[model samples]
Target: MKIILILVLFNLQSGSEVITAEFDDARACDLAALRTFQGVTAEPDMRPLDPAEGASAIEGTVIAHDSDGAEIGMYSCNPSRSDRREG
Candidate 1:
């Protein structure tokens, strides 16, 4: 019974350490850097379209990210074009 208790305590402590290490690896994301990587150069126009109804629209391109920081795909609003890569 003593040996079993020791093993249980060891497992619990090891599990807690693993959880703490995972939290330590977490980092805050930089919004500006992420936008720049996605090809969003500047803020989009948000002016109202109609006088009676208030609406806003933005036209730009979007690039998808892959595992190795490579652009996996892209989509454009102005030309209505979309390009995706197949694994």
Candidate 2:
């Protein structure tokens, strides 16, 4: 029982391999196929985002250009989007 529990915990925590999933630009959702030994896992997608908005809630990222982008107040993009994504 302890071994089984440990294995489950390990998989859940270390899991980063997103299955053949896709983030939909149309609805701003993801059709994720999670890992499941017994069956084909199909998780629900996220809600859509407002295209008009600068940053997105799901990723909190924006298409930042050095010229058009503003870091003072309106736009504040990090050095890398990956850095912001982790936060």
Off by over 4 Å in 1: 1-59, 78-87
TM-score of each candidate? 0.21, 0.17
lDDT of 1 by residue, 1-87 (tens): 000000000123344111111111112112322343344223322222232356433333333344454333332222111223446
Q: Could you tell me the TM-score of candidate 2? A: 0.17
What Cα-based lDDT does every candidate model obtain? 0.26, 0.22
RMSD of 2: 18.1
Clashing pairs in 2: none
Question: lDDT tens digits, residues 1-87, model 2?
Answer: 000100011133455332221232312221111122113113212122245657544333222112323211111112232324532
